[model samples]
Target: MKQNILTGVLLAVIALLVALPWFAPYFYIFVFTEILILGLFAVSFNLIFGFTGMLSFGHAAYFGMGAYTTAMLLLHLDWPLLYTLVAAMALSGLLALVIGFFCVRLSEVYFAMLTLAFGMMVFTIAHSWRDVTNGSDGIAGFRISEFGLGLDLVMGNPAVYYHVTLAIVVIAALVLYVISRSSFGLILKAIRQNPERVAFCGLNVRSYRLASFVIAGIFAGLAGALMAPFLRVASPELMHWSLSAEPVLMSILGGTGYFMGPFVGAALFVLLETWITSYTGAWMLFLGIVLALMVMFFRKGVLGTFLDWWMNKND
Candidate 1:
């Protein structure tokens, strides 16, 4: 069928991307790693913002939790990469569950504000807890050891790490896609469209929202886990409100309604940043102008607008 062909083509494209390091320049591998990690983070944020109709300004709380968990595990325990990542997910998920229980009680702007408050609290702890977290200096000099698949991995090789990141990100993205297509995802969508109607229909809308929140948190944590090792540090900046905005911007730029939109948006964002920064120091100013234009004209986002045009043309 036509759908199967399209799916195959998409898979082929992704396969090529995963193997890009083999063909592209060394610097590009680093850029691609950033794109993959940030793309996953954006997708996780979209689960709540796009599907559940919840705007959480504090989502970085989970991201930071994951990074800190992984960093501490690697720094103190010297745990293997797999174990560290698992711990990161567990810690982040627990935090999301606790925060989401309270957050889901409110709606719209109140929910965003409450999440933002919780996020700042997490950032404050990371910044002030000098004894444990190393305070503002962050946890650095962390290294990745054996990958635990019976293959000895050279921890210092950027190319190898890039491949590992690609594998993890692809798996996480696939899992998210499956979840988004499931019955639970449908219920969440319904709740988003009309929470009162969903509640009247015997569904616990709050619980569903919490579940989605927790799921998103776990994935965000995974992104954080990747980032910790990639960046060679885990600090309070991971928990900062500005860090939380990355996913929001990606989702808005890519189109929250489409599954691949955030990923596409992330790729564009990183590439643009890299190119623009090389040309001028005023990259932020340029980004601000571009984002403003996006908000004013391309409200549906790049992917959303493109999809709309394609669908309409076919019709």
Candidate 2:
């Protein structure tokens, strides 16, 4: 009964999020759009980290690949937005497949190290490939054309773009949520709990891990594809290790145990940055302090700990 109530509340919150742009201040629409993209990115990261227990330090490689893929298509090929997005997902998924094939062969720290290595390799290619990637300047001057779906989509309008991002993100989140609740998800969790035991049960642990990694990359690519036009650039910075860390931080902030934690964490993260940067130049320092406290005290994460308390209190 209590679980039902909590679920209802969560659904209401999502409803509120869906309607946020209608009533929120104009600037807030942009902010929430960013939150949605980063939230999806963090959620994708959590799939392998929380469910599969494989911490990837190179997740941003997929993000950057998706961003660049979409950007390049828009710039040189004059591709439709929908097709660009599809290309982004395909490219990112392929990269994840290659990376995961090697990374999943290892375990624990070895897996992380391999991911980081591959991630750096990706970053280097983006940085040094001046001929195609436009060097440090990245891709620009690519105006967003028709969405090619015969639908009116004004990419220049922030509110309209926000709505577009919201719609796509919600759809992706729903798909990811469904997958998380499936038997495949249960097997991933089982593998996380004990890979040896799962292998003993005749499961190919590495294969499962690889599949999850590819799925994660596909969604991360979606987020990246959305982000390209929003940011108006797909720089090497998107592929940086620092970008990879954003999802990790968001996952930690929200609590890895829960599916919706990353979204909450992304909101908190963007809100905090916006609020803190307005007050002080050392926003990162303040963020670090708050994050340290979150780890020290609310070890379960902002949403995780809050939900834990709420459920306990209701009990």
Candidate 3:
């Protein structure tokens, strides 16, 4: 019955997304596109944080790397969007491998701090390396000519881009869902609960953690790749620690225990920010208050709280 309810909710959300472009304003198309991209980004973060019990403070490094890779390829090589996205994922995964090799050896705060240090290193490189990254100015004026696969798309249209983003995000989410449900995913969860027990079972705990980190980085990179064209620029700010905080906030706000929690959180975060920023300059103040309230009262997050209530009422 719980599974049925979850399926119903998922289907309803998908249906709403499918119909949004037709019924919603052009402005909202862009809004939802941002939500979908960030939703994917948050979900990627959950792979390490929620599933593997690793809290990273520098996940934005992978995200920013992906964005920069896409922007540079588009600007200098005129590569197709699809090609650039693949490149972004590959490069980000490599970066994660090198970083995670050292990070997975530590647990808790140490792990978080090391990741932050590496992330800042990447950020500093992007900020100082003016020749390649265009320094702080970033790579701009990049055009999206085709989506690649020999299909011509009107990449400039917001509605068209929205549909494309929707398609990619849904596919990526499905892939992640399968991964989270697989045996490897189960071991990752076990390692999260008790790494010593997992290690005692002859499983390499650090390897699993490193694998999760790399997978999360790849998906986060994909999210960044999608973001570059939508924003039309890839800046050093994307790699900053502040940007890294977004996925952590979204995951916590949506509830990391469930597969769809981060996405729900992303929707709430984006929508609330959009609504509140319209009326005040102190939007962060209001947002912080809301986040504090949610953490204090709704420990499970909005969706998690709703689910708990629903299950209890049904029982």
Candidate 4:
């Protein structure tokens, strides 16, 4: 009954988000776009951190790689959005495979440090490779041309772009949802709870972890692709250690245990930033307060805590 209720709630939220572009103000349309993209990023991170028990400190590497891939292609080849997105996912997945091959060998802190090291290496490449990456200036002024399907669309139009972003994010989120609910997902949850027990059950825990990492990278890459067009610039900043922390923070704030937790967390994070940054330079201080409170009182995450109380109260 709880699962059904949760699913209904999620569907309703997605429906509202889908229609948001129609009712939201012009500025808010863009804000919601950022929230959706970042929310997806957080959800991808939660797959390994919350479900598979891996804390990756360098997730922004794939996100950056995906963004760069799309930016590079659009700048040089002028390819369709569909093909560029496919390329972004493929490259990000490959990067994950190579990195995960070694990182999965470690556990806990070691795994995190390894991922962070790898992530920084990628960041360095983006930063130092000035000939290709354009140094700190990032990739900007690249035209999107069209979104395919022979439709007359304006890439520069914020409203049209918001709709496009909405469609892609919805489809991608649904796919992620499907994966999180499958038997494989169950095994991942088991792996998170007790990897040793899963290994005793004749499964290679390392293999499962690696697979999860690669899948997360693919989705993160897609989020990156979506982000590039919105930001109009893919730079070293996207690959920074700080950018990687955004997802981690969102997951903690929303409730990592639940699938929709990251989304809720993303909305809160972005909205808070938007509202607070306008008034003072101490927005981080306020954000830190909220996070500290969440850690102390809602360790299960905002959504997770609320659900537990609501379910228990009704019972």
Candidate 5:
């Protein structure tokens, strides 16, 4: 019954998303696009942090790498947008593989700190390398030519881009959902709960962790790739440690235990920011208060807490 209800709710949400561009204003259409992209980013982070129990403080490294990859390809190579996205994922996956190889060797806070260190290293490189990355100003003014597959759609139109973003994000979300349901995902959860026991069962815990990290990075890169086109710039700010914290907050806000929790958290965060910023410059203060309240009272996250209440009431 719970699963049925959840499925119905998900379908309803997807329907609304599909119809949103038609009804929503142009500004809101772009806002929703941001929400989808950031939601995907948060979900990717959750794969590593929530499922694998790896508290990485530097997940934005992959996101920034992907954004840079897409921006550079579009500017220099003038590759199709689809091709750039592929390249972004590949490069991000490679970076994750290298970082995770060492980070996974450690556990607990050590792993987290190591990841943070590497993340800073990436940030520093992006900030100082003016020739290639264009320094702190980052990459900008890249033209969006073809979306590939011989589709001659107008890439400049906001509505058209929203639809494209919607399609790509939906497909990516579905893929991540499948991964979460697979045996590999189950093993990840087991490792999260008890790594020693997983090791005892002859499964390589570190290997699984590295795999999760790489997969998360690939998705993060995809999210970043989408972002660069929407924002029309790839800035070093995207790779900052502060940006990395966004997904951690989102996962905690949405409920780390559930597959869709991070996405829910991202939506809440974006919506709140949109509403709050209209009234005051102290939006961050208000956001911090809300997060504190959530942590104190709704530790399971808004969606998770609501689900529990619904199930209990039904019971």
Candidate 6:
């Protein structure tokens, strides 16, 4: 009975969150969209970092690929939003398959470095390919068309876009959550703890890791596809190493142990950026200081620490 009440309350809260843009100010609607997209990105990163015990520094490669794919589709083909997003996921998944095939052969720091190198290679291509990529300027002036599914959404309205983004993000998060709770996810946890043991049990540990990597890439690509339209441009910066750090930071802030931790962390991060940037241009300095404190004192992350305390108190 108590658990049912708790579940109901949680669902109610989620309902309110989904409806926030309808009541909140216009600027806040944009902020919510950003939080949703980045939260999904962070969650995808956590699948590898938290569950698989792998630290990838080049995750932005798939993200950038998604962004570029969506941008190109919108620019050249002008496909509907749904079709473009599908293309983005496909492109990112293919890239992840190739990259993961190589990276999964290695372990620890070497794997990270190898992924970083490949990511930088992609970044370089986006930066130097003047004819197709438009050099560093990226693809611009693209517009969203019909949303498909028989829903007639006004492309120019931010509110409509926000709802669409919110819906897709929620569905994606749910899919990830289901994956995390499955038998396959338990196998992943086993592999993370002891790959040798998992292999001894006749499990294909490398294949499992590759599967997680590709799924994470697909989710990240979805975030990137949404981002291109939000920003009205897709540039080399989307593929840069700095952009890759965004998800890592959010995961650390939110607590990687919990599925919704990155989403919470992304909200805080985006809100802080919005508030702080209005006061001064030294936001990065403040962010650096906060991150240092988080590393030193709250290694499990904000949600992780809070949940720990709550559980301990109840016990």
lDDT tens string, model 4, 18-70? 78867888999999989989998999999999999999999999999999999
Off by over 4 Å in 5: none
Q: Tell me the TM-score of model 1.
A: 0.97
1-315: candidate 5 lDDT, tens digit per residue: 877988999999999998998899999999999999999999999998889999999999999999999999999989999999999999999999999999999999999999999999999999999999999899998989989989998888988888899899899999998998999999999999999999999999999999999999999999999999999999999999999999999999999988889989999999989999999999999988977898779879987898888889847
> Candidate 2 regions off by >4 Å?
none
Model 2 C-alpha lDDT per residue in residues 76-191, reported as the tens digit of each score: 98887889999999999999999999999999999999999999999999999999898789987786887868988887888888878888888899999999999999999999
> Candidate 6 residues 1-315, lDDT tens each?
544864687689679877887799989989988999999999998998888878888899888888999999998988998999999999999999999999998888998888889889989999999899998899998888888787889966988898889889989999999999999888878878999999999988899999999999999999999999998998999889878888888998989888888998898899988888888899989877876787578778887887777667756
User: Where in model 6 is the C-alpha error above 4 Å?
Assistant: 1-9
lDDT score for residue 43 of model 6? 93
Model 1 pairs whose backbones collide: none
TM-score for each model: 0.97, 0.97, 0.98, 0.96, 0.98, 0.96
Query: Compared with the true structure, what per-residue lDDT tens digits does model 1 show for residues 134-237?
Result: 99999997777776667788867888898888889889999999999999988888888999999999988888999999999999999999899989999999
Minimal lDDT window, size 10, model 1: 1-10
- The true-versus-predicted C-alpha distance at residue 274 of model 5, in Å, is 1.2
TM-score of candidate 5 versus the correct structure, residues matched by position: 0.98
> What are the lDDT figures for the candidates, one per model?
0.90, 0.92, 0.94, 0.91, 0.93, 0.89
Candidate 1 C-alpha RMSD relative to the actual structure = 1.3
Global lDDT for candidate 1?
Answer: 0.90
* Cα lDDT, model 2, residue 205: 93
Clashes (backbone N, CA, C under 3 Å), per candidate, total: 0, 0, 0, 0, 0, 0
The residue-by-residue lDDT of candidate 3 on 147-241, one tens digit each, is 99998899888998898899999999999999999999999899889999999999999889999999999999999999999999999999999
Taking all chains together, the TM-score of candidate 3 against the true structure is 0.98
Colliding residue pairs in candidate 5? none
How far out, in Å, is residue 222 in model 3? 0.2
